[model samples]
Target chain A: MTNENAITVKNLTKTFGDFTAVDAISFEVGKGEVFGFLGANGAGKTTAMKMLIGISKPTKGEANVAGFDVRTQAEDIKKSIGYMSQRFSLYNDLTIKENIVFFGGIYGLKKSVIKAKSKNLIDELGLHDEADKLVGSLPLGWKQKVSFSVALLHDPKIIFLDEPTGGVDPITRRQFWEMIYREANNGKTIFVTTHYMDEAEYCDRVSIMVAGKIEALDTPKNLKEKYKVDSMNKVFLKLARNIE
Target chain B: MSISIKNISKSYGKVKALTDISFDIKQGELFGLIGPDGAGKTTLFRILTTLLFPDKGEATVADYDIIKDYKDIRSHAGYMPGRFSLYQDLTVAENLTFFATIFGTTIEENYDLIKDIYMQIEPFKNRRAGKLSGGMKQKLALSCALIHKPKVLFLDEPTTGVDPVSRKEFWEMLKRLQKKDITILVSTPYMDEAELCDRIALITDGEILQVDTPQAIMQAFPKTIYKVRTSETYRLIKDLKTYPKTHSAYPFGEYLHFTSTDENLDPEELIHFLEQKKHTQIEVEKIDASIEDTFMELTHTREVNAHD
Candidate 1:
């Protein structure tokens, strides 16, 4: 478990019944890096993330997330990493601030700290006027931002964003990446999965998963060069189509 | 075939969905209504298709007032919703036929228009629509939408969940359809798809941010662009932002698409500075701005304007 690598996965595999959702795959994400986990729908990106986060079990593999063995130290790994699923997990009935407070309280933040953090998060997101507004009343982009900020409330070492920018506008997606960059600057690792190839270009290094395998791994530019494609979209298409 | 919207506004209960949104679609033009989810694209489409009436303002699709000539408008306009709302249990052929029947036409009447698309999925036409792949479903949906030989078509994010190849195919079909003198107004969140449109209106939060040809939008980008590539491109992007002349720096593929406040700044100076910082394999070159870049600039400029 080295400090340089925020996540170390070796021959990781996950099976559901008889089908292997995540085949033998190995990859590493450096500390404070935004690692893009890219794949098509049901391409095992989510399954791999689930295993690393310790909620789902791996059939056969070895992994360390934030220097904690995912198998024996599931609790420690969970405590040290923040996760925002593709689905909006915040309670729609609660106020924006209330959702933050609720998540913060669960993470064992002090009441005063939660309050101050909520205020800061709201202001930073330009949602100061909407702090008292119900989470359901906000737009999808705002909800995504709030969900992201809440994921950072516990100050976890690694944050996993599963298609966090899904259905968001290009402007909001840019803003969301800014927030992720800020967190990365603060030395937090970001592991994100997205179907958007343009968004994948923003990551430090991206791993393209196809048919439950890590078919390509490199900086977006290198992958493009390797695939002899101008765009990441083309690189993905080449790899995905080749695998098929 | 011209469509115009004047001072259109709509609300759902207390929520203002759209406000004074005005735009036009020229005949045989591939117009794009670009926006995110809940950006009132569907609302506007519904109003123009005669499914929902706007709270205020007037709209005409293909020279017929949406309100006064709802029946005529309905007959001449084809709409594909954001969600695949076709009958799931129905076979692909059945769905297409049903839509054709609803429009008082049979598949054979307009078979030539959808023949290219329909032929791709003709083998699986007997398969249930729900059991088809995303790409197949897209083709089937487009075929169903075109079954009536409509003069104008409104596709609400037709390529949202489809694969990259399917998206490309769908756009090609739209281009082929445009040859028939059909006015097309399509909405999508994918910025890349915006370039495929003849003209696009970038919308956000119930307001139209910018409207122009994709080329025009790119040309309007108010900054000199540089593509900065290096060994640690990600780190370079972060470090470049701290440079005094940097206005905006974001990772674009293996390079950083950076805009500098000082457009006259030399690339040699940047390379030297990176060299001084012990950066490796650095390459800086002036490059063209993309539609996404233009969209970001427009949105940011609008936000700054609103704040002011």
Candidate 2:
């Protein structure tokens, strides 16, 4: 049995005056699946993600995110998904508990529920001793963990993480993937974009973007086998080289 | 040796940024400082470049003492910071010339030094640095850094945010620079990049973990590992962590890199165990150790040792 598509984009295109940022890209992300969007710098990965997350309006085509139309029903779409990026979204000055409260409040969670969930999350991430410390003082790895937990505060059906593990150590990055695997098991669809090709291997299905077009899309193993390469980095290089 | 550091230590207030770090880079060799954020790669680089002082220990770059010969060191060493610090409003050509003039040299005087690298960005020489693409900016930065023909180059996370294609190009440029017999010291968080270096120092939390050729480092790792995947990936990882024979289990790209304490452990036994757990789509394959695997093991042991 196939999983229901949590996201669907058909001929999705976004333009800025003369330039087409996302040119008629079409794909569907299955429910609870980890979808990897791989691309180089300015490959329109961010622009495409922005459109699907209901931030930027697509110049043409259609996208149904969590069953809401990106154009006509952006408000509803915004209510159902979470987002975290390299330029951390949470307030740095706030304590971990306070940050959770503020983010949970934005999601309209009740005060009591927020308090309980905050406690649980803090404990689960092993931040109990550091719960009251300002987020700015925490290490990058720990900070990322908190931001990820905060993004899940609303229990959104989907989360869009843009280079979530950038500049982090391999151990922390490996741990972050474990968190992602846990979330995927919990039925949360993850739509992630990264330039790190090794990360492509972690995704259940990956789509490569180059010069505003979907260049290749397949499982990491299949893509490697088809391209006759040993690693995803080589697969990405091969695709990127062909266009350049 | 192009660069040699002895017992280098630095501290920021109460926090130690680097501790007892010592290494040597032979002439024209590419050395990588491999670590995560807060690993003190930046601190060591700054100290070597004479941008900061170490609280303890000593070092030399291009045969100049980092402490007493700060002036001479500045003239003979080039540094590309983690961030692009070139003038945003100046065109690529203008930035190159400005750097050249400040170094008391002319672009023509050091033209031969940066020729190959500069040629890549020459087409965009008139474009403002801010207007250039990431790859272009990186090249422009390298060109400016080399305009004075410094004997040693220090690049801190030069490819951190660069595209894979540009990263490949930048490393290729580094290879060419190495042929010029200029020692290069680079720090990067990406583990796969360690393989490109002639030798690498694995650092974490401001201390050196190990220093050796990437191949030798991986060869030193003592583990029999398998890449395993099942339909229930999350649960399988948790279950495998508790498996009696398992040494460690963590997520790899598409599968879990499972290491067992038992060297001659049979794969069939693990298969039968997973089969009993009713997991579907089970696939297991043995794979060679990667640099990352070695780094993780070293750091993990260090953490456990610190705790004890």
lDDT of each: 0.87, 0.90
Candidate 1 lDDT for residue B254:
55
Q: Model 1, retained fraction of real contacts?
A: 0.43
Cα lDDT tens digits for candidate 2, B1-308: 88999999988888889999998888888999999888999999899999899999989898889999999999999999998999999999999999999999999998988999898889988999999988888889998888889899999999997778889988999999999988899999988899999999999999999999999998888887789999877789888987899878878776888888888999988998899888889998998889999888888778888899
Candidate 2 wrongly placed segments (more than 4 Å): A1-3, B280-286
Candidate 1 residue lDDT tens string, B1-308? 48999999999999889989998889999999887888889999999999998999999999999999999999999989878889999999999999999999999999999999999999998999999877788888889989999999999888875557557768989999999888999998888899999999988778887889999888888899998888764468667877888877766655678887887888888888889888998888989888878777777777888999
lDDT of 2 at A141: 86
lDDT accuracy of residue B182 in candidate 2: 88
> DockQ of all candidates, in order?
0.40, 0.76
Residue-by-residue lDDT tens digits, candidate 1, A1-244: 1358999999999988998899999999999889999886657887898899999878999999999998999999989999996575688999998899899999999999998898889888888789998998888888898999899899899999988887787767776887887788789999998768878888878998887999999988798888887898998778777777
Instruction: Find the candidate with the highest TM-score and give its number.
Output: 2
What's the TM for model 2? 0.97
Report iRMS values in order: 2.5, 1.2
